[model samples]
Target: MSDPAALLRAYDHQLRDEAETPSAVAVERLGPLRLATFRGGRGFITYSTLDEDGRPATQESVLALVDGALAHYTASPDIHRVEWKTRGHDHAPGLHEALVGHGFVPDEPESVMVGEAALLAVDVELPAGVVVRQVTDEDDVRAMCAMQAEVFGDTPEFAAEILLQVLHRLRTRDDMEMWVAEADGTIVSAGRLEPVAGSEFAGIWGGATLPEWRGKGIYRALTAARARSALRHGKRYINSDSTEFSRPILERSGLVKVSTTTPYEWRRDT
Candidate 1:
């Protein structure tokens, strides 16, 4: 039997701790959680484990930690939104309820998929006239961001926020990469590859494809390109928090759905 729990534990130990925010304004520890404050009044919460053995987390301790984490961010005048990230494979009993009780609204859950990079680096047949390549210039970045916002059905402001962050990272980090697929002089799909610092894992993120271009292997081809890039960077594994539409594709590419993660958001009262 494939041990999903074992894989999750290894991911938590190896990747979670090593992937700290590069530009966080403030970061504090509250029990197992790392509470981080970032630019634009954003806050993030993540933890290695609530219970490492996959047993149920103690309710009292869990509640206390949640309260403490909330207090830490709530006391900050700069924080306007906080996201508490939770994983399904964790022993986080009452965690959802506790977060909701504290005014946190849950977002949709996503599959946590992990696998060898070699499996995803296979060459895929691209549609006629479709081409994929890495992009860095401002104009290319803006075009990629616009296409992604349209594909994901998000507002332009959302893409603008992402553009700012990606641009900042581009200036500071060489491990980040952006790829886009184009046909007939227009972008059809886009994605990001983020190689975690000090770890063997790289993440494939922000994968979006125009509805008209679905099922033509464009997304898979983009993934293959990112996986090949990861290998060149010495990363052996690829991980992603996948939506339902992309989960099967990653599974077919040999990534295992070891767990699910949800984000609970707390927006400060204006």
Candidate 2:
């Protein structure tokens, strides 16, 4: 009775609409392709179905949309780099060559992963003198942000200034919180809980553990912390855009890879 494709499409739409800064965060139509910008210094490109682009729209319209959108971002001052998050299952045509022509470099395609929160909720073992807890202290948040920056290979380091800005925004609305795993006062792993209020879902993001501390179950433990937090907020489903390193773990925990996402990055300079 459930169509995975339809369900995935619906979930995608819900995430787009429920996000706080949903406009630029998910998809912003500049002309043809939707240009997406997020808080993490990341950019995204996507589009709605082009059924009405013409009397009988073809993939050419989609290609033009991408070209026009890139030109739009390259002209903006705020955007440093942009990525076109492409879905493998969508009715996209000529997207690959078009993106390459526009200077959008493709990253490895990752599973468009989905899972139930309950499946991931479980107690995990931390090393001796290690514990997982909610963290909001300036130092702890900054440390966590920096760890994330390292994991993503982003510069300008996710610093205290950026964390403060995020906190300032969180103070007015209480839909998100930060968590970290500490081993002997050192932040070993960290993540965030994002509640999509009025929806049956919450997102677990930024699950990272130091390389030396990994394979010892720290990632799973951090996920448990976030999943429990999600349940407390009345969220039933959990979602993440997972990479290869984490996909197997999620799959073992009962998540279904609903779709696939490929990011096409375009620069502002060329």
Candidate 3:
């Protein structure tokens, strides 16, 4: 796992196939792409690798694939927004221009981090008043989501939609778990652990902390809790799409930046 190339190979082999949409409500296929529809009018496009036929993807073929995926989502009236995920190491040639020409906007790219779950399972001492634990109750879940929104500056409507989706996942699925750090009965930090079925990878997602609560090991502790949970569920590897703030921390915690991922989004006009 220390060798960067080996880590990237392991990640591509074990994690990419089902990484994007484990909880998708419906899923379809378009050539090598998986067109996934989630509960909240969200659509996602992902594939393990674009070179499905032992040949690199050409500009024309990539453009045609992009158009086909968009057309499929556009035909579904309920899909208000769709995301076409692109990886830094992919062999796609005209993906960016094609997506832009087809009305897709790119988001900030994030590091695709991978490492041993055991490296993150160690005990980290939290601040004097802080404690981290997994939560399932509706009230705690809502508070966790609201705190994340405040920290990330998300719109109330967007936050509400995320809350509803989390609730639905909690009620319907057992593969995901929510964890939070609390001090004096208030949520200070929160995140989720998603153990991917039929894979050795578990994803630590939505790691957020209040500004005042950072630099006190609370976020790391919350991550450790989730890592332990993932280990208990029999997952060997930890993966995350990390922001700049969390990338250094995960790197310090033994995760390697295998690649980068950028999302190209397209929204239907209201």
Candidate 4:
């Protein structure tokens, strides 16, 4: 039997490919790597297994692929921010060095948490006037995106436009769903669940609650709702790119932080 870590890596490789968003724009295949493009001037790159995908492209070859893609995107002035998304569960041999060598700087490794849905589905008591609801309309989705921007310290326009694209996806395909908790008739907490096309795990993303509403267990409740939703779609596990704030909550809910993902950035000047 493969080690538990190996199983986790296999899962990451398959799940990411199946679960990626559609408006993802462009997808470039180099060996087993998937270098994808999305809206928001973003370039995302991921690999199935840095070492075990059976493609086994050499370190130098992988570096060449990164350079080729960077150069391709640099030709267009609109490509300002590129993210080389890495997973901690896989052996990325020389990925860090390669990315840095090509001028990509590493960002934080978010916690990747996954576990059974039953562990997270508990009724949480919000602070008296909060309500949670699923959103299927464009306006509500945009509003939720704007709120998330505020909480994460980003410009409202940046995320709203990005979410507009996501909304189009949600409308055309029913696989994606967004939910938020409303308090005093205003959204206070939110999250989204995306089911992978051919996998057993659904990715839980964009979870946030107002700073004032943090400790009341609203976030946990939001997670439970998403887990139950995932189960409805036949998904057995949930995964997330969690912040430190949400990590402990998820850990308490029985999800294991199997790996860490750090995003590296690069610019024309750098």
Candidate 5:
């Protein structure tokens, strides 16, 4: 068995710097952080060193970084939400405290799963009458997003809006693909596969399924479809920040949990 941590290290060293911010409208550097401004009032903060060197930043430095990023986003009237992504394996001392002190609310942590693409490409038995396929049309994408929102307990309209943004990017980003599983002409599960530019890894994101569809093999079928797509794109590995519900499924499908990621978010005051 290959070491999961080693694979994660390679992913961080080779992909973290460029794979992120591929769709950013603007990007700037502050110390070790990459400040990215995206469409839809979103701001993202990430650093390759956070995972590469594992150097712990002093509390003061962390605070300064937080303040700088917040100020950068707050100055833009269109920017409303900022996410400071933190990895559990990073040696960031007092980082969480600094973020909270700076008014960032931390979201739930998710498992960072990594595995070979071939391991996930095996055929999965879907529940009878369920069909999985790649979807590109506006109406199909909207339906998929709505089903995902309901599955994840989020606002359907908001999810659809984000999917629309992603759809716009699809015109230029052929590396990204969306897949849905349907039963009786209604979307029951949905997910996306993002093959990182100039990297061996692809990411499976936003896996969701209806409550009535849980425990079946529909989600796994959807994942396998993405994995097969990744292989076709020449990707060797698959990565995902998975919730508890999906982590076990991926693990059973041969992915390994290498770390955890938590996002600290700030919302602009209207």
Candidate 6:
């Protein structure tokens, strides 16, 4: 699993496809794409590969597929935003042009980090007064999300919407675990662990730490706590789409950057 090529292969074989859409409210198949609709007017598009009928994708076919996927989400007026997840290693031709031509704006690329969960399960000494633990109560979850929104600089209205969506998921789902690092009753760092059912992978997502808490071991400890939880749930591998700040930490924790993922998003107004 330490080998980058081997890890990337395992990721493509195990973590892609329907396994990526476990929490979708509804899912539809369009060509090779799995178009997912989630709560709060969010739509997601992902696929294992871009091959059509076992043949490599041509520019024309890729454009057609993008249009079809967009049309599929457009038909549902309730979907206010859509994100098409694109992998750097995918055999997609003219994907960037197609997505942009269809009104999708690309986000910053993230490193697709993957490795054994055990590597992240080690104990890390935390800064004085900072404590990391799992959080399940409504109040604690809200605080964690609020701290994350502040760290990420989310707008008030958008932050409220994210809080509602997160609370809804917290109430309705048991597959995800929320963790936080708090000091003197204020949350400083937080993240979520999503153990994929019937797969060996668990996703570490939404990791954010307050600026003042950066450079300390708080985030690493929070990750270790979540990794232990994933191990308890029988997941062997941990995967994350990490931002620049987190990629180096995870790399130090034994994860390899298997590839890069950039999300192309389209808002309803656009």
TM-score, cand. 1 vs. native: 0.92
Cα lDDT for residue 77, candidate 1: 88
Which is the better candidate, 1 or 2, if ranked by TM-score?
1
What range of 10 consecutive residues in model 2 has the weakest lDDT sum? 16-25
lDDT of 4 by residue, 1-270 (tens): 123465476466656652564557777776566767766667767666554346565777667777777886787776667777777756556777888998999877798777766778777776788787899877888788878888988766557556767876786777789999998878898888888877777888888888988899899888988888888899877778898999999989888777787888886663
Output the TM-score of candidate 5: 0.94
lDDT of 5 by residue, 188-238 (tens): 999999999778889999999888898998889999999999999999999
Residue pairs in clash, model 2: 32-65
lDDT of 3 by residue, 56-118 (tens): 789998999999999999998988889898999989998999999999999999999999999
Q: List the residue pairs that clash in candidate 4.
A: 109-261, 131-182
Displacement of the residue 75 alpha carbon in candidate 5, Å:
1.2
Count backbone overlaps in model 4.
2
TM-score of 2: 0.84
Q: For each candidate in the order shown, give its overall lDDT on alpha carbons.
A: 0.85, 0.72, 0.90, 0.77, 0.85, 0.92
Number of the top lDDT candidate: 6
CA deviation > 4 Å runs, candidate 1: 1-6, 18-20, 51-57
Q: How high is the lDDT of residue 235 in model 4?
A: 81
- lDDT winner, 3 or 5: 3
Candidate 6: regions farther than 4 A off: none
How much is 167 displaced in model 2, in angstroms? 4.8
Clash totals in order: 0, 1, 0, 2, 0, 0
Q: Which ten residues in a row have the lowest lDDT in candidate 6?
A: 157-166
Considering only N, C-alpha and C atoms within 3 Å, which residue pairs clash in candidate 6? none
Q: What are the TM-scores, per candidate, against the unseen true structure?
A: 0.92, 0.84, 0.96, 0.89, 0.94, 0.97
Candidate order by TM-score, highest to lowest?
6, 3, 5, 1, 4, 2
lDDT of 6 by residue, 135-243 (tens): 9999999899889989889888668877877888778878889999999989999999999888899999999999988999889999999999999999999999999
